[model samples]
Target: MAAAPDSPLYLGLDFSTQQLKAAAIDGNLRVVHQDSVQFDCELPEFRTQGGVHIQEDKLTVTSPVLMWVKALDLLLDKMKRAGFDFSRVRALSGSGQQHGAVFWRRGASQTLNQLHPDQSLHQLLQGSFSVADSPVWMDSSSTQQCHDLQAAVGGALKLAEITGSRAYERFTGNQIAKLCQSRTEVYRDTERISLISSFAASLFLGGYAAIDFSDGSGMNLLDIRTRSWSKVCLEATAPHLDCLLGSPLPSSSVQGPVSSYFVRRHGFSESCAVLSFTGDNPASLAGMRLQQGDIAVSLGTSDTVFLWIQQPRPALEGHIFCNPVDRQAYMALLCFKNGSLTRERIRNECAGGSWETFSAALRDTPLGNNGNVGFYFDTVEITPSAVGVYRFDSEDSEVSSLSPQVEVRALVEGQFLSRRLHAERLGYSIIPGTRVLATGGASSNKEILQVLSDVFNAPVYTIDLSNSTCLGSAYRALHGLAAESGASFFDVVKNAPEPQLVATPHPAAQQVYDHMLERYARLEDSVLRKSCT
Candidate 1:
């Protein structure tokens, strides 16, 4: 007999950089209810800007641990007010901003187990973290730690071969090393270290949660092929690192039922299972159900372009993370740190802080901005490893001046052109007829996406929801449960809804960016070589 139509629902949460969002999906995989709490606006008590605090020195970027805990409390409360029935939520899994590590105090496990329904998580867990604030992914202060780690593990290539990417300063391993070196006593008192995703799941699990393989791939410690911690890499970072971090779990596997704390507090059943949480990008892949032919561009706080692949290859410019849906497959990614912030800055300078004017300027200026290409990096960029604004003429030569309208178009075109260039090197094919699927906050902007389509010379697409990470987490929960019930993941997603084509490449404009890509690549090479990255 077929299962009941009113089957238990699955809950997915995304602890993203700027906000905490939750989504509920029913047995049919349709989003039932969803809500979000923006950290900067909703939780001003944390005094965080853009969901982070950048130290005055400007290298350190962190968010208060208590603020995240409090966000959970507020999010859940808001969800309840929005008519989310916790009792119907049969399974929960989530995605979080990758690389950020949370240091649990020695007694944190005890605190988790003893959570009281009458109290908030932030209230009960005030002293649960060894570190009050966690070094987030935006932090690039671990430059020394990255070098030390690469040296300890032979070299950059060897380490990248083991992990997915090179020793990125924002990676958890380097961040942990920095913490240990900066505050030895706090590192000594830490009982467990959790990635941002697992840390959030541990709250519902009522104990330390294991890191999933996909998220683990972002850390410079996990051997991606084996899906386990690399001994040499671990030894290089910290002492007995394995003791602090539990074995990495496969993303498809279920962690366990929700703890009695949640059972008592929110009416969750003892039978409600919690799946292992992974990084937001990986989770977004699962949510988008990315296919081999499609390229996914996430335009959030950080702009990233990723595609699905079967084989893993070593590349310095981008990343190859284990697929969240399939343990065997891999996903290639190129992350640009100056995503929304850069766009916002350009808008402020050129359009007087109005996205409408920015869009109008983009449309007003002809595609390619008359052969002028601009690379805007308001912060340290991950792709080219460069910083600051750069403008170049038609011949890939540096130019001094441009109009605000021209600058706006150039910035948009330059961003997508760089992605196209690096992605090809990372083994992503960007042919004339390719399709680009867009998601995240900025993906909804048709004007911005039009530039993407024009530059890539491909049609752009968007799913029903812009925030696919949480929805994908929800889908993943149901998919895992369905897998246990004898249904395949591919079948579940394939039978689900298809993304709508949002924008098609302009025929004449496509030719312009197609030709400009070469110019952009030349300038990109010169800039990267000069930076000595």
Candidate 2:
């Protein structure tokens, strides 16, 4: 629906792997309009599968840079056709998939700044990129660079301490190193490097937008503690790197006013402010209205657990990024590859492909599943790095079969147990008033949420919207304006609708999960040892 014409609106855009999405909200924090353009569906001319091209080696993956540019054009036109009131939009912010890098060719800044209102962004900036395709988070082709970086910085642990993460293969610094080594001419000709988040913001700002610290933390080059680029790490990545990467900005920094192109073509007000954009995960945190002591569990195709942190413990596993809402705080994230699909497989086998039956199994089973636990991984898992299905009984004895009801409960309990165990390993502990906010496909199941509440020993809530990333960007848009007047993010969004309270912890939750958690950790370790052998 069109927003009330006079209501001051905030706009948030998400440039994700497969789609470019937009959400606009009024000052009261109500989402008024939404739109998206899917790359593979809308732009079939790119001939992309899942919006990316997987190279022959299969380790390297990328998306056409121009495809993203064209998506923005299409998205704006869509909003215009729908009678969106761009003039009412007072501020804007956005998010992009983390760890992707975009290289601007020398003199491209001039082309960006002088964009003519008559031409589309894609048509005007056709030759603006030094690298036609950007290396995205899915690309894992920089293993050699990862090794060299770890070696140069002492070791993986030390590197993690310095840069909030070890030298990950898909990290921008390692990706940049790979480009410098393999495609020297391209790196040499590159005038500036923008993380995907900053690249999207620049499109609206009509100039280069500074990389926000939240997204910059994913590059394995920024010192999370200092909130600045690490000179040592920069030297290891490439020559003259500081200039190529402009100074990182706070995620809530007001970048500037809307570009002339947007003002003239889209009817956006020239006075509309553009705020720094951040990574999708960080934006979701904002959208979820996460506060200190709150944990957000996104139960998508791959389940992710993230929380706000006052004291970050950088680890070899998981990641630490600057908090988008609170500059002094941090965020830790953990991903489980075995999520909804694995659950679906079990549901089909045990419940005749019925979610109702699957939920009934959960409601009927006792907490902790009577000492039964199962580890289900149809593919190689990211955490604990194990594969194949393994079941154990009360005695910790490996078993080949389980009763259908027991199997269903085991899968649900084990997944939540692992999330709690790993999140704690990253130095997250359940404290007083801690709330677990759950979002994703599986979160709709009340029975599943009850189990999540029992496992975490906290009240569980569900968001009103599914697209937290885009919604969060809209929240961030308001924050950029309010923060300048010394308002906290919580203060800015306090009047928004509260997440629905879905489940509360059972009185015996702590007592039940404590013993099971220890046992589950031991079984996971045992599986890891067997995998290594």
Candidate 3:
């Protein structure tokens, strides 16, 4: 039977670094409504810049827990005022910025279960967190903890083999260790430790939501193979850590129905299922419908490249997470800190601050930029730990300068080439029918995408939607409904709009980039070696 026009809806929410966003989709998988609350602009009382507070040491970064609660209250109120029928929402799932930790107070679960419909969530739950300022993903103050953790598990390689990642300073386990060591009282008072993804789902679940396998892989504590917490890692980090973290759940697991507080206050149906939420990147993998042979390239403030893998080769440089969609599969991620901002800086310096002028330069220069490759790192780069600009000529000799047009082409080409290099280092390769799914601000520019296509030697594709993560969460919600009945993630989203083919590799692209890649690798190594010396 065909569904009615006013059929059940699924809601996906994203608790990002700077904002909280939501997208609702109907049974047909078309977006019905979208909304967001920007923390910096909407909540000035918090006085947060970029929705976070960087401590005096500049290494500790945090977001006020109550601020997120207040933003949710405000977002729901706005939706209610807009006459969004919450009763029609059959299920909900979401994504949160990865690696951020939230510490629940001893009696926080009680406070959550007893939420009053007449009161705002922020008002009732202001004291629910043992740590008022939760350490976010931007924090890098847990270096000591990261080292300690890596040592506890033998070494970085051993840890990565177990947890799907090395002990990154921003990872939740290290952050927890830092708290336990630095703030002993706070750690003692913390009843439960939830990653940001599970923490948001907890609000709707009326208790605690188990961290999904996909997001739990970000912490250096999960045994990704078993999809459970590692006892060695837990004992090394803190006392009774497993009790505080609870058990890990599958990403599509139906947590339960929505809380009574939401049903009474916002008219949500009592039967509305809440699915386990995952990390923003994993959610995006679902949204983009990335297949086994596809690579997803996000060119936002920080460029990120991710892909689905049947067998993961965990490394220290990039991250490997349990695939959110396929229980038996995994995903790999490579981050480059210098993305749009670096492009913008180059555009301003060489093209008078005009993307139009910048693109014109790209069209003006030939492919491979006459074998003039440049590594431009405005700030420190994450993938290859390097800084400053280093230009190399066709002969692989370091050069000091190039023409403005050449500089422009070199910058764009270098960025994509580096992505390909590192992605391959993580065991990613271009097979027949491989597609590059591109998103983020820079993806809209065809000229830039042309370079991306040429470097990877694959057809480039782009999605029309601006928020893939939120949409992915919505898709996850619907998948949760069908998962128990044995529907695959692809089966659930078969009707999703196909990504538009933005660019295709030039016939000669393989020949040109094949040689350029070798030279680029040598130059990058030289730069890194020089930086050390």
Candidate 4:
């Protein structure tokens, strides 16, 4: 099982919220096989609704650590069923949901290195984690932790300047501090801590995986400019946290060989390399092949808007993470918690759980929903950090209710308009010259895309594949392979495919959205103020 003689294939895995997905592609970028293992459907034993457990509070979301290990085992089996030859894969890389923490038991590295192929991974690594449940981005139970960390480091703005964003409740730093405070013994026994991406890579590399800079940025613990963990922030989180969280590496760093267990069980070549895993958003930027003027609008479980940038100009409004593709650059991002699930809620209520009906409702309404806008947060939103549903009418005044059609249109418009406003603040503009690259589950909806284009008043484009994060990881693998061959990353992935223009703005879209965005900003401020009062 040392080495296999064959054409090189690259494998990319995405350990996203709802599932574990893998994509295999050849040197020419032809997809050999794409598959997934859904946590809710395939692994019903875990009983995850959206690949997470709801302990006590609805907002307290976490996932079982052993469930992820078993998911990997099942995923590899799925690849075998799909006729994927693992030995032919030259390099592997991965993407994972951001801001989630994974704790490792003192001897976890040994547990990983000595994985028994004969036994299931979950059975062997049963006690590998100090904490059984890992906190994910969806969990907002760390508000007190967030305030404490920010107060410890000068203030919220100062922390934002040092790291990427202000201490948000879902950030890994806050989550870690909460864990350390709540469970002191578990913290003491923990040896290594990882971002979700690093945790997945550690399994493949048979050792502690260094957190990638791009993913590390999401933790609110990495200095965005230095690309290193901040000692000051570490002190704010927990005791001896510096050693617990290993060094951060660039996304392009070659982690090591695929674990011997993989070679023995799955027939992967011993020489196969593993690249540092990155956060899903950064990986999507790689998959979309975004240019200077193009913006990425990913609409999955969490909706986000990001654009590539050159400098690390940290802002309090959004995030500035080191670009996964370029070690010398940065990317700006604005994430919203109310995404596909909230959209589905509205669709189910207003459109009778019919997409066609939802589309019809979305399209028939005039642009700006005839001056009706609303903020719908089924969960706590990241930016305003507020929850609840608020409706406004034509005169920009609060309303008790609206028709199903109006409500549907308001929800879609409100979501994109919020993105548009924040994106512009981050120096991304949507004009005739620029374009929005749409990706994720909701990207295929023409109605939604049209709303996006109109709200931003720019053309919206999508590629053949909707799940760009998984493919992005594959592209990163190929890029790493090319770099090892003395080739440029652009040269390696340039010929893959181009984004197809899907929607153009309505003639009056720019004017309508301009007014709506301004109105939304004011209403958003008022809502936050009222809630605090």
Candidate 5:
């Protein structure tokens, strides 16, 4: 049976580093309208002197809170242009870039409200922060802090055993420690430090500070089993956690109603409820209709491989990230910093011409590139390691020494092989029966998709949705609303649109991939051993 046409529209806002993207979805899980607005981050002044990185002393960079507010306003305008009825929007939630901190002052409401021509609450909160841009997840300057916290909690493996994750430079707890060490004055003035998702939700609902489990898990401060802030982790890192942190909430809970001020300013009706916000990746998993044995691969500037697991698994060799989206689902994630960009570089510099030309080139080249050649694509490694290294190698040194074309193919094949190995290590059986959903820029490349399919010997699927991240956020918003009215979360997802295409692996190519994968594993081990020593 079809869902009723009168079902309420759910609004999802994806808060990324570069832009804010908004989407509206109906009860049938169809996207009705979508739009995005770009925002700029103030660059910090830095210099390279005497082979060491130096930053201007007392330097503080911050994002204009007006940017988010303006983004919201522009989204509303775009929605109106798309013929969407703002009043029909039933529930709203957000998915933000995980681990970015936003500080809000407790007693400055009167001061905040009077400061603006624009009624954006995000802008009003700007005055409350000493630093504009908090150390985002991409910032890896907190390596020392990560090492310190890991030692304090125990060893890296022991830390992962307890918290279900290992210490990383980007995790919130480490960033907080870094700030305290470097800028103690600013850390002292901090009031309520919240994740970007919770901050946005708080802004919309007037004033509240609570994060969903998915977002909290990314902080490295939450105990995976307890689903709450870990006192041991916090005390070991930042002892004075008083107002700097907030309570953790489930993703489906309604944090609060849209504030009257926000309603008056944005012309939104008072009937809308704000659902708890979550991490964008978790939201994407929900949006993809992910299940056990199902993997979702996102190939943007970076590649993230996500699988839903029933048990609380420890972070794999400090390479995997496990975070709970809800009570029933935990996401095991592997992210690669070098994904589509590496492929694009290969296409432009190596293959020459458009992506179609690149695809054709791969097809023209025989399986395994006709010999023992492979490509290593790495701008950085998000999972497994913070640094990235790329190299092309061949069993036949003559083949490795000769042709750049062979080297390019090798690199591409190596990337696919690396993903396969990583998946296998995580206990995912990458055999013929596994369901692999590929979404991102690389998914559009027939050659890459076919190569991936051939390598995995599994069916590769892609959907028509161009921006699956935005779609995922919209799906979460819808689910959040439905959960409020006694709807089963899994049932709502089971009714989502079927995948667009299913590309099966070629039997002939699988044997070649099997051999290449063995070589790739050996190469990866050597690289890791060399890097560590």
Candidate 6:
């Protein structure tokens, strides 16, 4: 059935590592209904005693494609429950985690239902290659592959220039290279390779796969400026890898219709168009209404800080990533792998399970935490840092050092100062004149926000939406559809509610932070020199 001409709706999906969330909005961008379903990625366990490792079973890191089908079913069921007409949904799209690869054979003529119904698809592919258990973006066992690619491509800087990012252990290119080198037989049987975003789109549409620019940019195979797959990168990294990695389609392109299986199982209209998929981070930026000069800092399990720049800037040496969100915009990002997890760990083990207790203890310490003594908090540092991992130690070598409470204050102070230093190196001006938008779990913490505002000397604001990534994906889907039809993107976003609160920097606190930032930089430099050697 075709969608109603006047009341066409759009659907946006936020596909995370653990679940899939779907949101539907009408032609006017008013949300009709939203629903989500949890799924598990069955990851294998390995034990290491001393330096020797024992694989108890074949490490199966599996997230069934069936989970997505189930999620879509649930979504449609919820929409129906909410009194929505299935035929009203005209366009559908999604955002997924970047860098995961999914594989399928070209000659398999069976529809998704026939293949997936009895779980025979798993059995069929298992005979040829590792069928299920696609390695997700979080799998970081490819460190050796990263080093090899860096060496093959000359060096890390050269690789960064060509790939628009430093060689990361979790990138798709490295993962494919590792498989080719270690499991040559399996690599020979590989037919087509695609990122999770493209694969999910293909599953829904029942055909060949193609990813959008946002997801492709994360694979390290795309030339950022060209917005296309790099033949040079393919040859240098994995020559035998399938070209079915496919050309990157624009985010607005209509991939195809929901498969017969999907329509039959979930009762979706046959006319629903599956829009191209994007990465979650870019979706979050879109959701936050990030434009040029607007920075979005997400403090999740890991902290990611990024901004949408009008033009592509030269890649920074440290931990900078330049990912293209669309043809006209590029997102410059930094990822702190152990961001909130580190803070939570400190709260639990060091501060006795309460952040309030920790904050209170930190506050009891004086400004500058006494004199010149400083703390280094390196749980994980992402930016233009010479160092990748975090380590904490005192800056001053004096016998009469600060007390433990003062030491904790210095640690928190240094963490914020470090972020400020990194922001500046990436061409971001950390001054009171700019407004910084904070999101994720950390934004809810008043103490954290206050510290961040003071360190950057900027007003920190949090939007009304808590799950900005999901909201951003939905907003992007709506905007993309609207733009295709010559409608206004700003008009849709402007009507949304303003931030709940804004925290301004304290002048006296800013003075203390300014001096602390300099000393922190020097300490960071010394640590980097030691680590690099």
Alpha carbon lDDT of residue 433, candidate 3?
93
**Clash count, predicted structure 2:** 0
State the lDDT of candidate 6 residue by residue for 23-64, as single tens digits.
776655566677765553221221212111223443313344
Query: Relative to the unseen true structure, what is the C-alpha lDDT of residue 483 in candidate 2, on a scale of 0 to 100?
Result: 96
Q: What tens digits encode model 2's per-residue C-alpha lDDT throughout 1-533?
A: 55556989999999999999999999888888999999999999998999999999999999999999999999999999999989999999999999999999999999989999999999999999999999999999999999999988899988899888888999999999999999999999999999999999999999999999999999999999999999889988899999999999999999999999999999999899999999998998898888898999989899999988888888888888999999999999999999999999999999999999999999899998889999998898988678888899999999999999999999999999999988887768899999999988998999999999999999999985468889899999999999999999999999888889999999999999998999999999998887777
Candidate 2 vs candidate 6, lDDT winner: 2
For candidate 4, write residues 403-473 as lDDT tens digits: 99999999999999889777766656554468888888999899999999998888999865466888889
TM-score on alpha carbons, each prediction: 0.83, 0.96, 0.94, 0.83, 0.82, 0.80
Write out the backbone clash pairs for model 3.
Answer: none
Model 3, which residues run further than 4 Å from truth?
1-5, 348-361, 364-366
lDDT of 1 by residue, 340-361 (tens): 8889888999899999999999
Q: Which candidate wins on TM-score?
A: 2
Candidate 4 backbone collisions, by pair: none
* Better lDDT candidate (2, 5): 2
Estimate candidate 1's alpha-carbon lDDT, on a 0 to 1 scale: 0.86
Order of all candidates by lDDT, from best down to worst? 2, 3, 4, 1, 5, 6
Sorted by TM-score, highest first, which candidate order results?
2, 3, 4, 1, 5, 6
Q: How many residue pairs clash in each candidate?
A: 1, 0, 0, 0, 8, 4
Q: How close is candidate 4 to the true structure, as a TM-score?
A: 0.83
Model 3, span 317-436: residue lDDT tens: 899899999999888999999999999999999999999999999999988998999998888888898888999888888899988899999999999999999888776878999999
Taking the tens digit of each residue's C-alpha lDDT, what string does model 5 give over 184-286?
8777777778787887787677665488877787776787667777777888777577447767888877776777765665555688888887777777777
Error of 3 at 15 (Å): 1.4
All predictions: root-mean-square deviation over Cα? 4.3, 1.9, 2.3, 4.4, 5.2, 5.6
Q: What pairs collide in candidate 2?
A: none
User: Candidate 2: global Cα-lDDT?
Assistant: 0.93
The CA lDDT of each predicted structure is 0.86, 0.93, 0.93, 0.87, 0.68, 0.64
